[model samples]
Target: MSSFGAIMVSFPGAAHRQFGKQIYTTLIPFGVMERFLMVDDDVQRKLNKRRVKSIANYILMGIKDGNLCFLSAITATCRGPIQYNEATNQLSIDISTQMSVNDGQHRFAGVKMALDTMRRKVDTSQGQQRLEYSEKLKKLEDMAIPVVIFGNLTKVMEQQLFHDLNLLANKPTKSVSLKFDNSDLYNAMAKELKNENEWLIRFGIETERTSLSERNRELMVLSTLRNMISFIISGTDKDSNAVLTLENYNTWKTDVSELIDKLFSVLPEDCNDRSRYIIGLAATIQGIGKYINYLINKENLSDEKLSGLKKVDWKHTNPHWNGAGGTFDPVKERIVFGGTGGGVNGIYMKLIEINGPSI
Candidate 1:
């Protein structure tokens, strides 16, 4: 039995001292875990509800019968140190001691919510549905998560531990992260497009997960494609808080892919080089994504307008782009004048204007 300040809570687990710290490990059940945990806001930031809800959705809606999921061990501590009996492999906390979480707060909250939701489903459901939900509830109740507990520490020590846990970790680059994450719908779509589209191959696709180098051969990166699809879905180049969706993912996929194909077709053979055409630049593709969204979402895009790209002069020599978004530099092989923010907006407007009459 557990909850902060409850009667003595005991469980079979193990503990050992590491670098002057006593650490404990255990597999905790969801029902017991929900009541067993607490948090000190002073040591951790306020919970992000959106993040918690995202995790909850993964738990409830994840595509599987067994609902296979994984979470790293939660890091935590008791208000007072826990005692362990090596012979029995039993761990116990004294009365009034509290189990507080230092990390994995979001996962903890999500699991608790999923457990509560399943219980409600079982209670309210009728007949076969109730039986089905009860089965699910049993499985959920049986779910156990690995947890790591630090020996009792003061508030200052907790703050330091939290800081080290968050700040010391290095995150993977955006491109690589998206490439490896098949769970995200957008990333999955991007991978499928990359393999199926020949246009991506001819111009080259960047898989190294870095910005294109001066002599780089790639026209676009995986992350860029993933973001482009997101932009197209949201129909905005600016940051948007609204959720994005596509009526049929393929319809927009074909439209945007055709738009890109046509735009690239109009350019000269030398257009693949970033130095030869501002259109070859990554920022230009970003702008194109916004424009494509605008065309579909605002202008009621048609076949003729897409085909009209054959008429636009996309060369860097075009005066429309010179002062508006900086100039092309042959020596550096990069944009010379306009910076990133100003440059993206410039390219976006230029795209609309370049195809204005026909559009």
Candidate 2:
């Protein structure tokens, strides 16, 4: 009992492939995965709490709806020896020593957390609801993901494997991700607003780029619009429920489109070029979002509140933004806009101050 004896934990695969000299591919159940995964702290970096939470939430959402969630295979290495029965296509790993997971610790942790959450929920439910939850729990417990196991690797080898696994992998741009995602209603509604409204169509929105270039004619990026819409609708910066109803989508689209039109009406109209004014800057967009979020409950937009839009110096090189939206790089000969940080907040605070009580 003190030490886990040499009894092997068997991982059965439908079929197995050996890659290079020692890598073996296999499948592992969620049940067995939680117990055996050990992170070698010396070789791996610390687990990210946010990433773990996001993964857990995604799995839980899929499980609740009885849908399949997709993820890449997790990597693990044999500490000493791996018993491979070629005839049975099974991998036997010993639990006597610490066999560390070289990659995907956050994913493992997320799955574990999701299971724990279901267990807790199952304990509290009643009758048919309880039965449904129990079934979901069982389904989750039985689910398996492919695992890539390596013949005993040294610390250096594990480190190198980690590097190789993540080296060239790149996440898509935020705008592109929002454009393709059908999960959240906010992104969909934002896209709808852009497509339906004539003003927005003329203003131009970047569907792929993260930031607009100085010479770029587009005012806002799709991802930035998604974020602003998320804030406006949910009053926070988190993904809302996956609401796919056409009615709700249309309703929100109209309301948001009207609000955006109200903003353009208030700001100075640049006829020749939409990008000539500061109104379309990402920071300004977010600032306007924050201001509009405060007016969400109001039925009417009075002339008094929007008077500040006219007071603002809407030029691209206005001196007011020197240390506010961004600092001026004298030698670089350009204004460096702050990114996803204090710049947006600075603009919001200035808006609130200037838009105060119809002065």
Candidate 3:
């Protein structure tokens, strides 16, 4: 869309939400929304050859409203504070850690998306000239948006910024466990898990983990989806039976449905995309498993206590084992516990007490 009369558009939601409406309602028919492409970094990367087919299939099957993408600079800034200057048509962002130009590509994409939607024209002819102009635009992208992040932020200020971004993104905090209690095991596990935050974002929404009402639920859904996806993408023909046999378009739909009915049913009604919720729950549950195993393998839990444990309910285990041991008990969902081992030490029978009126 080419325009001499410059108009800037900014919003609190994704650029698609803003521009989609504008293009459909005002720009497209008028033929104003044309020159610039409104692309998110995340969207572009996932559009590659391999993912393209699956992504197309997913969209066609209505499996995902939005797919995972490369982390964008605009999204990366959620940890910091943001200020939008409507008057000057700028966004100012500040972070404790200075991000490089390459790292800021996604943020630049956000601006590009905005400019595209607003029908701003950039001179695209010169190689060096284009870089120079974009460099200047990059500065505007950074200065116009204000974001500040540090370990030393005041609790209240940090919380305020955190919440503002969460509400803006419509994030749910139902996935992270142990956030509220801050239990010793949870703290240790969370610290370790954060180390893998980058890789974890591939199948999960790392940015919005803390905003859920039940972080465990979010974690559960994510972990399961990742595992399921990996199983499909990396397996031998037999192992990846789901993807190999089903038409590509049906794969995501069936898998997502099963995942939702199994994992995220614990959540209350009203959440969008039950599939995303399932993915989050799976991630949280896997996190619990990773952490619990960390404790178990580290010998953090005493041998006696570990031995005394006959069964564990993964479902009841926070952040992990939501399927507990993955066994169905007909009436009960899933149960986990120790089975009999070769005994000279003898077997420990752990009795769990359940409450119900006697029939």
Which has the greatest TM-score? 2
Candidate 1 lDDT tens digits, 1-359: 34455566677798888779889998888767866788779888899988888787677754245333566788887887576888889788775566789988998998888888888989999999999888877777777888889988888989998998888988778787777775555666678777777777677767556577547767778877776666666654333443433336667567656766765665566666776666666667667677666777777777666556567666666767765566766675456545655666677788788778447
Clashing pairs in 1: none
Q: How close is every model to the real structure, measured as TM-score?
A: 0.75, 0.80, 0.20
Ranking by lDDT: 1, 2, 3
lDDT tens per residue, model 2, 1-359: 11445777777753344555487788778877866677888778889989998898888877655344576889987677677777887777776645578778888889898889899889999999999889989988998877877777878988988887777578789888888876566777778778878777887778988877667766689877876776555544563554334457677677677777766776766621434555666666776676666555452445456544767776656666676667766675444666755767766666666556332
Whose TM-score is higher: candidate 1's or candidate 3's? 1
Name the weakest run of 10 consecutive residues (lDDT summed) in model 3. 342-351
Candidate lDDT scores, in order, read 0.72, 0.71, 0.31
Deviation of model 2 at 133, angstroms: 3.0
Error of 2 at 224 (Å): 1.0
Residues 214-250 of candidate 3 have per-residue lDDT tens digits of: 4233332332333333322322111333433223534
TM-score-superior candidate, 1 or 2: 2
True-vs-predicted CA distance for residue 240, candidate 2, Å: 8.3
lDDT for model 2 comes to 0.71
